[model samples]
Every structure is written in C-alpha cells, then in structure tokens.
Target: MKGTNYPNRWLIALAGIVMQICLGTVYGWSVFTKPLMAAHNWSNSEVTLTFTIAIGCLAISSAAGGYILDTKGARIVATIGGILFGLGTLITGYGDQIGSLTVIYIGYGLVCGLGLGFGYITPIATLVKWFPDKRGLITGLAVMGFGLGSLMLTMLSPGMIASMGTAMTFYIFGGIFLVAVTGAAQLMVEPPVDYVPAGWMSPIGKKSSDGMTLGQAVGSKYFYLLWTMLFLNITAGIALISQASPMAQELMPSTMSVGEKAMQAGVILGLFAIVNGLGRLLWASVSDKIGRRTVFIILFSTQAVAFYFLAGTKDMMMFTIICSYIYACYGGGFSTMPAYAADIFGTKYVGRIYGWMLTAWGAAGIMGPMLFSRIRQASGNYSEALIITAVGLAIALVLPLLAVPSKAKSKDAKVA
Candidate 1:
C-alpha cells in the first residue's frame, strides 16, 4: 500500500477536536430548555421531550453513520454530518419561531441527531488510524474534546441565550458549528498505506496471544460483555444528567432561586464534563500501563460505589464529588472502548466494529432516561430511580470480571 503523509497527525487530532466540539453542543440542551419554556410557555416535560427526541435520534443514527463511515470514508460522511447538523439547528430555530413541537423533534432530534452520529464516528475512526501506537491515548484525547466541549457550551450558551434570544442563539451556534465541522472534515484522511508505528510490530508478526479480527471479535462473548459495560455506564450517567436541574432543586429546595438552581446545575454539569474529559485521558493512559481489563475492573467497581452513594446523598458538595467521579468513569469508558476493541480486534475494521459496539450507547440512551423519568413519575421521587441506577451500575461492574479477552488468530493479534 502506498503511504500518504500530506496532513500531519496532530492536525488530524485537531480536526477530531473540532468535530467533537460541534457534536458536544447536544450536551448543552438543558441550557436552552428553561428559556425555551419561558418564551413559549411550554410544559417542562414537553421541553424535556425535545432532548429525548434528540438522544433517540442520536442512537438510531449512530448505527447508520458507522456503516457509512466504513464504506464511504470519514471525509464525505463527516461533511454530510456538518451540513445536516447546521440545517438541523437552523430548522430548530424556525421551530421555536412557529412554536411547532413537531418541527423541533424532526429538525433538531432527527436531522441534528443524524449529524451528530456521523460527526461522532469520524473522529474516533480517524484518530485510531493516525495513532495506532497510542490508540488508547489518541482515542482519549479526541473523545475528551467531546466531553470538554460540553463544558465550553455550558459556559457560553446561557450567556448567548440571555443576550441573543433562543432563535438567534441557535442560528449563531449552528453557523459556527457548520464552519468548524466542515473545516475539520476537510482535514481528515485515512492513515498511510502499509504504515506501521515506530517500535511496534503487528500482533500477527510476533508470537503472542491470538485475537480475533473485527469480524470475529463481534461474535465473541467478550464483545457482548464490553457492550453491556458501556450500556450500563452511559445509562446511569445520562439519567443523572437529564435530571440534573431537578435533582438540584430537590436537594436544595429552600436555598436556591430558580436561576441559582439552574446555575448550580450548569456548574455540576460543567464539572462532569471537565472530569469526564480529563478522565478519558487519565484512565485510558493508565490502561496502557496497568492493562485494559484491570482498568475496566477498577472503573466499574468505582462507578458502582459512586452510584450507590449518589442515591443516598442530597449534600451538594458530596453530590458534586460523587457525580463527577461517575462522569469520569463515563468519559473514561467511551475513550477506553475503542482501544479495548483495537486491543482485542485488529484495526482492520475498527471503525465498523466500534460503531456496532456503540449500539450499547444508543440503547442505553433510551433505557437510562426513560427509566429515570418513568420511575420518578410513578414513585413521585428520584430516590427510587437512583437506586435502580445503582443496581444497573452494579450489574455492569460484574461483566468485566467475566470478560474473556479476545483470542489471537495469528501473531498480528499480539502487537495490536
């Protein structure tokens, strides 16, 4: 295979960063909801349902986006994603203008969700190809941008809404995302032909543990174990995030003004993003030194503990600390998974395999929030909902211990 090195690897990573930043705006949906409700006089559940639609779209589109990325290459898929995302935002603004809930669901939920699915996949695939030697670290860095991007929007979007109004805010944010994501798409390229990282050899080239190719890996039990692990982690985290403001209100009913409650929620959410972003890097890098399986064990166990404690505590400081730790595990889980897949399955079809694995995320998107909201509605409190989340986390923690590493098919399996 002929190698091409026209675009620098760091530049590729930067492009991934840009793509994630745009994609991460979904995390800022909460900031828009209250304002939207005040302006339109919509019910809280009605406004919150918009987010549910967006997340549902994100899940469904992720599967399709993965297939597209594998077949068409990252550039075209991501460019399309950028366009869809921009249009979705623009349409969402129009939806707001018309007070049409359906338009918001279709435009922001379906279209932008499709865009997010495509945009999210490209960076993961590209970064893996570029940094084969440091798959975990590279994946961590690229995905950490996704986590941190939420922090950025959490800080910026509220002020933008205050000054510019909801429709204008969407228009501006959409345009900015379009420009940034489009430019990032232009910078994306597949890795060099027949290129191998320095001081590294293919697992097939050396004698080591046999592992499956991407195709074979998916068929194995370990794949499902990893899948379940991610599903549980994301479900818990999303549930917490979806109800963040309400949770804060419940905790500090007397002291917090509505604005203060929202601000505090924003702070907690931002802190989650920060810790989540940093945890991706920190945990994935640690996986390199300590081993992936070991790291998974630690993360899952810690997450279980955190979730258990989160259910009992209404203390703001304690809540923040516990949730932050949980977010770290959430972020770390995402960053580590690609490398984990690469470790077990070769990069031959890492993108597709990873995409398939992300079905866990999509499925969890539905289960987590649905479970939280439904249970809260039925029980008239969040405590029962949280306890259920803790149970889910505990269930997730068991999967890693039972996980069997992918077997090597050839010497190439060892190097990966």
Candidate 2:
C-alpha cells in the first residue's frame, strides 16, 4: 500500500499459505490421540478435550485477531501468533514429559489455539483486498495450505511419534512452527487503500461489495442463518474426523492384523486430507463460475447422501469415497464463507467480519467431536452417529436458500 518496492500481491498470498500450513496442523489431532493416550494413560474422551479446547480457543481468538488485523495490520498480529503457537507446542512437549494434562491444555489448547486464531485471520482479508476480481480463488489458495498441512502431518506424524515418542515429536514440530510462521509473517501486508487489479471491473450491483460494519452484519437475520449452516456442515464432517482412524480400523475387515488395520486407516485419513485441500480449490473455483449459493446447495446435498451411504458401507473403497466427499464439502464451507461475505458485505471490513463468522466453527468443533464420541460410547458403533449427521445435513440442505442475499431484493436486507 506504499512505495512500489514490492507490489506483487501474489507474493503476499504465498506468504499467507506458508503461515497457514503451520496453523492447519490442528486438524491432524487424531494422529496424536492414540499416542497421547498411550503415553499419558488418558481416556479417549480426555484426550479428545484438547482438540475441543483448541478449536474453542481458535474461534474466540480469531474473532479478536480479526479486529486487531483491521486495526493494527497483519505483520504484528501474525508474528505474535507465531510466537504463541511455537511456545505452546514446546510447552505441550514438556507437559508430556511431566505427564501433566493441565500443562498440555494450557500450552497446546490455550496458547496454540490463540496462534491458530490469529494466523488463520491474518491472510484472508488481505488477499481479498489484493485480488478483488478473484475473491473465491484467492481465498481458496490462501487457505488450501491449511488442508495440505493436515494431510502432510497425518502422513508423517505417526512415524515421528513412534520413532521419537510424543514429547520430542512435539519439540521438533514446535520449533518448525516457530520458524515457519514468524518468517512468513514478514511477507504479509495490506494493499494500498486505492489498490485495484489492472483491468478489473466491479460486477454490477454486487450487493456484498457494499461496505457494512460489524454492527450492520450482526443485526441481520441471514447472519444467524449463515452461522447455522456453517455449524451443521462442520459438525457432520468433524464428527467423522474426530474418530476417523478408530472408526476406519473398525470398519476394516477383522482379518487384518492390528498394525495392518492402523496403516490402512492412516492411508484413508491421509486421502481425506488431500481431497479436503483440493476441494477448497476446486469448489471455490466453481463458485466463481456458477455462484456460491448454487455450488453450496450441491455440496450440502451431495454430502447428505454421502453420510447416509457411509453408515451402510462395509467396503473400504466406498467408505473412502464417501468420507472424502464429506471432508471436501466440509472444507468447502471455509473457502466459500469468506468470499461470500466479501461479496455481500464489501472487502474493506471483511477481515474482522469473517473473523466473527468463524465462531460457528468454534461451536461446531465442540459439538462435533463430543457428539461423535458420546454417541459411539452409548451405541458401541458409529452407525447411529452417521445417521444423525445425515439427518442434520438433510436439514442443512434447506438453510442455504435463506442464506444467500440478492442485491436487488432489499438493500441493507440485514438492517431492515
């Protein structure tokens, strides 16, 4: 936004993804569940709480970071986020050595969660500012690193845990997180206030492009509906994600050895992460062409059916496809919502506004894993849990119709 020393906006996006890759490691929590339990003798539910707490903290911290991003800019916020995340991981490793869940909770959940929140918001609104003509695609690229981060970790983490044990594994990764995030933070910057692409033209009557403050967005009925839609989408996906390794191993034929079963489950889980990243790119790109609302309808509707079929499938091939579909759609929500908001509310204030919207992800993080764990404990299987999610998705299919806003229908529809 200043002298033309470094005016390449795409470079800023690349930097954003580098930091996001480090932050996205949260989704790989399942990879740590067994190791944490075995190392510490914690119950399944107890180990699960770390993820829940982290996501809850992520949601709350992200909301605050968005405000800070709007006020202070991305570099300082992201640098601080890096410090906390790396420190949290280092502390979590120490917590493991001492067998202290409280320490792990404070470090990994509270401190790392803050890092995730701030880091998550750091790049989004900045990218939207730099690439107004490519909002969906740009945000998708910036966030896709997050999904890839999970995929990469899911593949490598088990080996790290097995070879180094959990404590040293945390120490090594913590150091990496610190270096990667802090260095990448240097590359992030807001565009000049009057910045626009060389030949980009604002779409005629693009309602969301009109500037609206946080107060204006919060007062609208559609905001609540959008929140509910995000909640339902995440709950269905994370329910399966929370217990995917265990559930997949169970669904594998009993003839396989325990090691074989675990390996196979890891492969499937890895694929879910891969497609999760790809889906963000693919679906968001499609939204640019077809409109966000229609693409979301297809995403939610397809996943609803996928969840139902997931309950009935015994074959690994079918299960893999269905779960990947669910994961892809689940990921689609993250990329779509930010662009959708900028489309309706204007890009100028979307950084903080989108941050406020992520609370649904926080709420769903708590709901999804707990729902999956509780239902499995009660029923001794994931079938009932799958059916419940299927039902939730079926209901979610109708919510998006109410969520989309047309500029011509009512100006300032929310305030009205």
TM-score of 1: 0.91
- How many angstroms is residue 52 displaced in model 2 relative to the true structure, after the best TM-score fit? 0.6
> Per-residue lDDT for 1-416 in model 2, tens only?
23455468888889999988888888888887777777778987888888888888989988999999889998888998899999999999999999999999998889998888988988887888888878889888877888888887788877777677889988999999999999999887887666657767655554224568998988887668777877888778777888888888877788997556656666778899998888888877777777777777887888888888988898878888888888888788788778777766787788788899889888998999998888888888888888888887887878778776766135323211
lDDT of 1 by residue, 174-258 (tens): 8888898888898777765466655566554532222355568777887788888778778887777767656765677676566
| Highest TM-score against the true fold, candidate | 2
The superposed Cα distance between candidate 2 and the true structure at residue 391, in angstroms, equals: 0.7
List candidate 1 segments past 4 Å from native.
Answer: 1-6, 204-215, 253-256, 406-416
Q: Lowest-lDDT window of 10 residues in candidate 2?
A: 407-416
Q: Which candidate is the best by lDDT?
A: 2
TM-score of each predicted structure versus truth:
0.91, 0.94
Output the worst ten-in-a-row residue range by lDDT, candidate 1. 407-416
